[model samples]
Target: MRVRLKICGAVLAASVLVGSALHASSKPRENVTNASDRDYPAAKLSTLRGKIAYSPGVHAHSLWVMSFDGSHRRQITHAGAHADFDPDWSPDGKNIVFRTERGRYDSNNTGAQGIFVVNTKTLRERQIQPRTGGLFPAWAPNGKRIAFTGLNPTCCGEVIVTSKPDGSDKRIVKLPTAAGECLAWSPDSTKLAFCGHQGDGNWAVWVMNADGSNPHQLTHPRAIEPAGTGGDSPSAWSPDGKQIIYWSWQPAGGELFVVNSDGSDAHQLTHWDGGDEATNWL
Candidate 1:
């Protein structure tokens, strides 16, 4: 997704922190525009499954892959005319799917974009879907489909959609959220967990079958939490496919919370002074 999505309790990586350590035993190939597998001599780097790709700069936010511990940081895309954000990894860990900014936000109030997948080894890129109003791209665990957010003709409501790797056979599933512009595939890739808005003007996390049926709320959390509890963001199913892990906002700040997929045994796992957001399970 190209928009600078706002979370009730979230931190946007809107600014690029200059002077990042770009040191690498073998620097990624020099051609930032395009590359081949030979350009990425380090095959093992592409296979590193636990690394994360995220946008963390001000203008033209570029994608960066780094270890959870903040080591082996590598910047993937050169700052183009627009920024790149919301990266998702393929099941094989060989490529990353993300969105790059396109047209200016106009009267429609949405930015236009296309989803692109980058070869982790070569750093070469290809388009999965034409530049439309698409946002977060989530790869299916079964490797058969990818789920992402697309804008309605009004450039307003975002609907969840799935398509083949090549962007064919598109299907739409409906569940709405003011900030829930994302979907998380279950470990088996049969269900998705996302945020849904309430008529009362609050948001709750909801889950549904992959085909867009059986939608239900998983987080009917209290509207208030001792002057802290406020809201949650896109959620991910635990690796075991047992619980959904997500971040919620509170008076103090954002905190990570986990709840059973069936909406039972909600658990708060942290009490940091400020808060935390779960970007990905890995």
Candidate 2:
């Protein structure tokens, strides 16, 4: 009876349209035929910007990777029903860390919720934290560790934890609150940015030092929407580590926004009337 709650704030607006028909051997059992499969036009950037990895499938989660200019689009996993989502590229761009569910949503649930790594060059896959119910994997800038949200099934929620790339030395960085998730490692790897409920009873973005020290609130709880509006969610940091990008669903629509790491200078980045949610800076 372990219910799966969609990881808030990780969903992107793009559709999951598989570019090529090359399928993987461990493909999950789900229908992606109706998924919107379109690739972003690739463009060249002057610097070696990093790629943005996200799950784009509307019905069934699918993992996709795109360059900073939306070029070099590729699908890293084809786990149909398992719903491979929340992809994070390795710091070196050689692999991706992601999550997947096994079997259909209703029947034959493997409880196979864990963090996995996929080789970008050869399309090889391996489980890094098998059956641990881990998600939102963020690789430390130093490339020695990965921070992710590990669900405590008995506790009915999740917490942030870090481990070596090989799944060794796993340690949970307990949050002040039990509900914190969506970890984003700072560029210097000294802190982790996440979203959680503060003592004020609303969801706001917060940050903590690498060892879970100095838990500071970044966004004011009052920044939340009025009743019936969607809540704010955790998001990615700019390459320079000066700002973070998140989505806020107001009365008009959901839009991407940037805020200083210290919770100052919050401003909108996209003006799509319909809405724009996912944003990652290279």
Please list all clashing residue pairs in model 2, or write none if there are none. 17-37, 42-71
lDDT of 2 by residue, 138-176 (tens): 788788899887765466556777988877898878787
**lDDT per residue as tens, model 1, 130-229:** 6455666778887789888776545555677788877789887766454345567898999988765653334567888998788877776557533223
RMSD of every prediction? 9.3, 9.0
For all candidates in order, the CA lDDT equals: 0.59, 0.59
lDDT of 1 at 168: 87
Q: Report the lDDT of model 1 for residue 57.
A: 42
Candidate 2 Cα outliers beyond 4 Å, as residue runs: 1-75, 103-112, 153-156, 198-201, 223-229
Give me the runs in candidate 1 sitting further than 4 Å from their true place: 1-48, 67-72, 103-107, 153-156, 176-180, 198-201, 221-230
Q: Predict model 2's lDDT versus the native.
A: 0.59
lDDT, candidate 1, at 262: 91
